[model samples]
Target: MTTIVVGVLGALGLVSFFHLGLFDLSSLLRAASNLRQFILETFPPQFEILPALMHAIWETIQISFAGTLLGLFLSLPLAFLAARNLFGRWVAGAVRLIVGGIRTVPSILFGVIFVIAFGLGPTAGTWGVALYTVGYLAKLYYEAFEAVDVEVIEAVKSTGCNRLQLFRFVIVPETANTMISQLLFMFEYNIRASTMMGFVGAGGIGYYMVGYVQMLQYQHLLTTLILTFLVVMTIDYLSLRIRSVITVAKN
Candidate 1:
């Protein structure tokens, strides 16, 4: 118990030393004042830009959806090859290593690379999101595939089913719902990621956000933020509802 307390105190001390800033009464008051001024500047949002904001947000949705679909298509085969339960250890290890390497790079870096290659547009953003999605979904899929009941797999194999047939008839069916759930989660994540892709000129509402910051258009920026918040919240709620329904159906 004493050792545990000492470790906890040391961890807290390190966190405070590295991650947190020293806070003083004056610093807090100054921060509060700055926040109040910023809020005042942000009010009376520019409703006139609603049409443009809507269009930009729609583009973001398109990028995310396209990327997620393309990623899902690409990830399926990679995941199948990476499943240790389906394939031998050597094959699974090699495939998992490739997937892990892909995942090691940040999605934003992928966006920057695509932007450079494609020369700045939604095209770059879409491809970047797709590649990132492939890495993520492949990992999720293989894990889900591996988690399918061993007894079921063995039972199917005992019936003289080939490996491919086993995967098709047993593994796929058992993991289909989980696959859908992960896909939905990735789509939701990509929406937010797509917004950042615009920073590198990959295209999305983030481009407008950058412009607003540069031009000091606080009112318009606030309006854009509000719309984005609402859209994200709506997507989150819908995803939760769908997942819950899927769970109920599975049960």
Candidate 2:
């Protein structure tokens, strides 16, 4: 544990005994006045823009749902191929490399690229969300695939089943619950990201958010933020409930 702690601190550059340091907490104190001023100006958000805000919220939800589904459709196959136990290292390694490369880039960066191609809308945001989902969920799914009982897989194999039959009967059933759980988690995350994508003209609430900020319409900004917070919390609650139901049904 001492070695692990030392390694962590060293990596954090917390001590010049290990490497150079750049620790600075004083700036936050300096920014306190600005933070206070911003908060004071932004409270009790305006409800005048409720209609527009609702539309934007809907767009964000749709973008997130579509993007997550797109990722799920593609990742399911990739997950199977990337499962080391199923496909061996030769296949898994290549898929991992591709996935790892995608994961290296941020979703916002992907949005930047897709915005240029798809031209300033939810399509770009969806593409960005999809790629990130692929990168993130494929790895998760492959891990889940690896954890499936070997005996069950072999028993299915022994039935003279082809690869498709094996995947259908063995892998899909074993991992369906895990995949659903991950899907809900990813959809929640995608909603947050898709909202941010609007900052880049990729479409949805972010556009309104950035506009409100630029105009110093802090009340409107506050309102938008409040709405976003409510949406997130609601989704989180619903997702928790759904997952609980799934878990109970499984048990």
Candidate 3:
């Protein structure tokens, strides 16, 4: 009876999908045609724009690294306050509210506003990315703090360790690995977001891509794409290596 019911539900889902035109043949054909055109147009990336591309790529990396580091520094105290085990309930609630409010605003909107306020430069992009990253990293770090072993905390308390000492000796060590991992993840995301901020004149590889595409320079756009890919991949690889080393050390 259960198997029959499951099969019926699966069949109904398939029927609904088809009814919604999820598998429309014409849509597939159109997508294929557009993809073919894009492929034909964007080939053999322009090597001539290497100097400009290199500059933009460097700016993108700087934006990402600076923003991520700023966020990490700002988030440390906020994460401690937000952690249930670290702060009183009221303090934790207040910290959570602030973090939540910051996160509710989209990062792109932050970038746009910063561009206007700071007058369109990498500084604006740095702050925008940093603000977004703080919300995310603070939340992750708080959760890590919360997940620390209660017994270890109690042991430290029994030794007459004050709140600050307990935090230093027990909580920080317990969550250090997780915090590093979260920072790396946030850095990876910041690299991607920095590119988008360039659209608002925040000075990154994305700005160059927009300029090139608008000028109908498809070859340059392709080269920018390749360069961005290589840079992001290298950072991701390094982050993974560091994370693995940390994990092994902890074990």
Residues 129-153 of candidate 2: C-alpha lDDT, one tens digit per residue: 8998999999999999899999998
Q: List per-prediction Cα lDDT, in the order shown.
A: 0.91, 0.88, 0.89
Worst lDDT window (10 residues) for model 1? 17-26
- Candidate 1 global TM-score: 0.89
* Residue pairs in candidate 3 whose N, alpha carbon or C atoms collide under 3 angstroms: none
lDDT of 1 at 76: 91
lDDT of 3 by residue, 22-138 (tens): 789998899899988877888989888888688888888899999999989889889889988878999999999999998898877878989989988899999989898888988
Q: Estimated TM-score per prediction? A: 0.89, 0.89, 0.86
Taking all chains together, the TM-score of candidate 3 against the true structure is 0.86
lDDT of 3: 0.89
Writing each residue's lDDT as its tens digit, candidate 1 over 79-145 gives: 9999999999999999999999988888889999998899989999999999999999999999999
- Top lDDT model: 1
Better of 2 and 3 by TM-score: 2
